[model samples]
Target: MKKRVKWTLLSLFIIVVIIRIILAFLTPGFTYESYFHLRQVDHITKTGFLNYNDDLSYGGRTLIFLPFFHYFMAFFSLFLPLTIVAKILPNILMASITLTTYHISHSITNDENSSLLSAFIVGFLPILFSTNSFTVETLFLPITFFIIYVFMNIKRNTNNSFGKSNSLWLTIKRKKYLYLYIISFLILSLTSTLTFLLIIGFGIYMLLSLMENKKINKEELEIIIFSLFFFLWVQFIFYKNSLLQEGFSFFWQNVPSGIITEYFPKVSIIEALVLVSTIPFLTGIFVAYRSLFKLKNKKSFLLISFVISTTLLAWLRLIRFKQSLAFFGIILGILFAPFYLEMEKYFQKTKLFKFKEFILPITIILLLLSTTIPAINASLKQDTPTEEEIGAFKWLNENTPTDSKILGTLEEGHLITYYSKRKNIMDDQFRLIDDVDKRLKDINSLFTTHFQTQVLSLSEDYNLKYLVLTPSAKKKYNITEFNYLSKQCFGLIYDKETKIYEVKCELK
Candidate 1:
């Protein structure tokens, strides 16, 4: 039975990797914030690790952005080309997540087939599939599950060793487990700010355990102290990197605010059902709550922790729309394992037309299809910059100075920085810089104002060196060859068939 489970899990992982490769091929360019990360990886390859002074964005400013994911990619880029590494790394990390999901679910339910089913569910979750490209969230998924799995093992050991006299000598002997937990915590903390949410979940579990026992266990205290220490350390690094002048104000001013209603805004009720697979999630929650009071069922505590932590972060707007949904999907898979077993038993007892023989297989196939089809279709339709726009960026790379700062739409800022290796005043990564509103207003005025003086003033204020007008920008600003600025401004350096232009004239 164990061998069969292993084989089944291996097969699911292969399927996930294959799908990710197919998506990577179908969608050629990076998506969204991936360009920023690609640039960071390039930086790491040139310089050593942990160099936070990114000269590409915000006109030669420093950022305290997380570097672990980029560092990981850089290590791989040592031997292979970065393009190849980027294409396959996310899929590899995602496969690891599938394996970790299976182990976590099996630890909770001790059922092989059900655990494999859980792995299958997570492997094909629509949100996971959608974000499985080169992104930090993809890396976060497996680390989050691995941390929970380690925590569960620690709790099980402590529970089994209850009243066994945990002396200092015993603590000394068990230092390895403590080291493992601390290492995992550091990885999660250094990888992203999202680790704070995981720390909150661990705190809740510790609080619940204390309420029941009236005292903290040795393992629990160690975890709490280690987590608190690292949390403070991460915050300190952020402050120090921000030069302590901005302090926490940097984060407060930069991170955008949004309401919880924005979570999964594009997902219809049907898609939500398909993403979460309503029956298993509902059944898992029911079973977990019913088993909440059982002494041996400590696994239920972690399940509850997942639900509370993810929901709280979603409500607080700490995570993005798809990210919140993806985390919930993992929780659903864990809970669904036990629910599947219960249903299997029911089918066997009632002899319900041999339901047990086909039910699990049919459900897995349907769930996989629901997510896989949508993800592939979405990948095929994913939008990227036009060839002309890319050509304009390439021309800038060859013609402009390395440190030149350009003022353009936020949509093009990332591409400008990544492809041209030049500085952009702002980009879609608004959370990483300060004065987003003011910078956006400046860009808006530079494009929309009909007066050449205002345009020159805005350019002078931003220390602008060049202007790139893509087709979208031209259409939006209604710019033509005979525009007023064209008569007053300098000559165009590069013009593409797609009507994209790179102007070499000064504003003032």
Candidate 2:
């Protein structure tokens, strides 16, 4: 039975990986975020990897964004093409998450069937597949779960040895566990700010355990305290370097302040739930809550802690609905395993159908298919930049000087930086720069204003050398041509095939 379970789980993992690779091929460079990530990889490949500043965006300013994901990809780029690595990295990371999910769930439940079911759910859940893009969140899933697994195991080991003598030598042995826990915690906290919320969840778990047990688990408490201390110390470094100031200011300006409902639309919230395998997830939540009350064991504590932590973060708008939904899908799968197994057992004993054995597998298949098919299809069919747009970007790369600043709509800013390797006045990453509103207004005036002097003034102010008027921008601003700036003022160098235009004369 164990052998069968192992083979089945391995088969499922291989299937998931094959599907992800196919999807990666089908949708090459499908996401805008991928371009930004690819650019980072390219930068790392060129340079030695200690540099954090990206001179391509915001007119050659220092970047405060986390480089963990980029660094991870860079290591792979040594053996493979950067493009191939970027395309498949998300799938690779997610596949690891699937394996980790199985071990974590199996550790908690001690049921192989349930653990296999949980692994299947997480490996192919549509919401998770959809979010398997080139971003920090993609890598966060596996790292976060691995940390939980380590934490739970540490707690389990300490609990099993509760009566051991508190000798100096024994204390030294336990310090190794603390060291492991602290190292994992610091890795997560340093790599992504989203991990901070996971730490918050750990705190909640500790508090709830205290409420129930009337005393904190000393080992868990020590790990949590050390995690918080290191997390704050990392934040202090970011603060001292002025990186936190830039990020916080950007967040304040862009992220709306309000309740959760105000932040997410009804349709989006609905989509998030459905994408997460809604029925199974909700069922699992119910089961987890019931189990939490009935059994105060380490397994129950870890399960409920994850669910509650993700829920609180989602409720407080600390994470997006999609992200929260993805996290919930994993938890829901783990929690739903036992309930599903029970159902399977009951179905197996039924006399109404001769094929009662097929019931469990069929139900799981249907649930997996219902979500997986739509997500895969949607991912393959997702719209990316047109061929002409790609060609124009390529042209800009060849023609424009490396340091030339191009002024365009915010949409085109990052593409210019990523493809052309030139500086953009502003891009979609509005949160990273100061005075985004003013820069946005200036860009709008540069494109929309009919006055030639005003256009020249805005152009010279930002040291912009090229003007890219994409079809989308032209249609958006309702401009047929550059009516204000004539040939004498600004030479139209490359306007034959592409929507982009280059200014020939240098400004005084």
Candidate 3:
């Protein structure tokens, strides 16, 4: 690809990202998860501390990714309302992430066309697009791509070589190779845990490296060790502080009772292996057997590394996040860019029809549909509070005092409290619950007065405020007496007419 073509692709990716950002803000993301994070952002913005819950993990570290984004909104805050910007800005940043992946993919293969294809793969992806509208998914994909891009760059250029003509591992240029590995690991720790697979790949890449200087120097070993230690230190501090401070340790449980029957059933060991390789069933078995003796040293090494590492990651994840290996599939697809380009050219030269003729259309359709179909259905099908809910939120925003805490039976408590500039006892995200056991008990207590008192006693023990009654919560948690008490003691300050009610905490 020429310089003009490269810039044009990058420019187009930026424009598509801008469009996604526009769509994200034009309407509220309207997701249960988005609202949870939006409210968390508000809590951090106002209090400069995350006090909504005592979970140490739920703090400002989310802001590391927030810098380029948050400040952009803050720069806009001279005139616009700050809360509104906080709500809209994450999606915009997500759009930028899409663009970054495209650029990175393009850089890796030195193929402008492939880069554009990967970008399109990202752009038309419905989950990725929707991810931009919220925090969790938005942060993971972009960060994952960025880390992968960094690895590819270091892989390609450590020997000071560039372009598609070379794929040699004899280039572990001492600390240059190790430095990039360490940086990739650190970035992965900061964002999503998916870097673990990438890290394993990089480690294999390092060990398989044909070191021209065969002997190791003490200095080089120390630098590599130090780089690794530094990354580990940072991750340990973050995880230990976050998890241990809340006084909980990790545990494993039996697979969900409901999972065994689903197509998504803890993607069994066998199926996961096939999915990760996309290896042609029993045909792959034959290939592995034959290749054991036929291939040269380098080919054997590369084949083994790719197969073994990918299979291990897939099996590990299939049990926990059965469908999560799809991201790994995307990475494998990108890695195939160079080889695909070769095959397309070969077929075009030999055959009557242009191999290149239908490749773009096919890739685009498959990629976009893969991403968009699920995303569109999920978006359309999701249930959120209706107009009545919005009306109630508005009413509370205008009428209630900023400091007035409310007991809301609706999930709306967190977001309402966020926008209204009040503190919340909790949000729907499990991370916000410092004591998951206690929170679960509070949830169960919703229907019975005895249970409701257990809920109220926490307020009495601390300083209580208002009780909010939503029709949804009444149906889900409580029915008669608790509803009556909520009506009598903490009378409705605002009613959404759909049966959602916000009441001031008389107990507080």
lDDT (10s digit) by residue, model 3, range 187-232: 5456544444444554554465443223333443454465456646
lDDT of each: 0.70, 0.71, 0.47
TM-scores, one per candidate: 0.85, 0.83, 0.64
Q: What is the per-residue lDDT of model 2 for residues 162-274, given as tens digits with 9 covering 90 to 100?
A: 44455565566566656766776766776777777777788888777778874567767877788888887886665445545555543332432322254443335566666
Q: Which candidate is the best by lDDT?
A: 2
Question: TM-score winner among the candidates?
Answer: 1
CA-only RMSD, every prediction: 4.2, 4.4, 7.6
The residue pairs found clashing in candidate 1 are none
Model 2 scores a TM of 0.83
* Poorly placed runs, candidate 1 (over 4 Å): 161-177, 210-216, 240-253, 256-297, 348-353, 381-388, 401-403, 428-434, 447-453, 471-494, 502-508
Sorting all predicted structures by TM-score, with the top scorer first, yields 1, 2, 3
lDDT of 2 at 429: 56
What is candidate 1's CA lDDT for residue 103? 85
Using TM-score as the measure, name the better of candidate 2 and candidate 3.
2
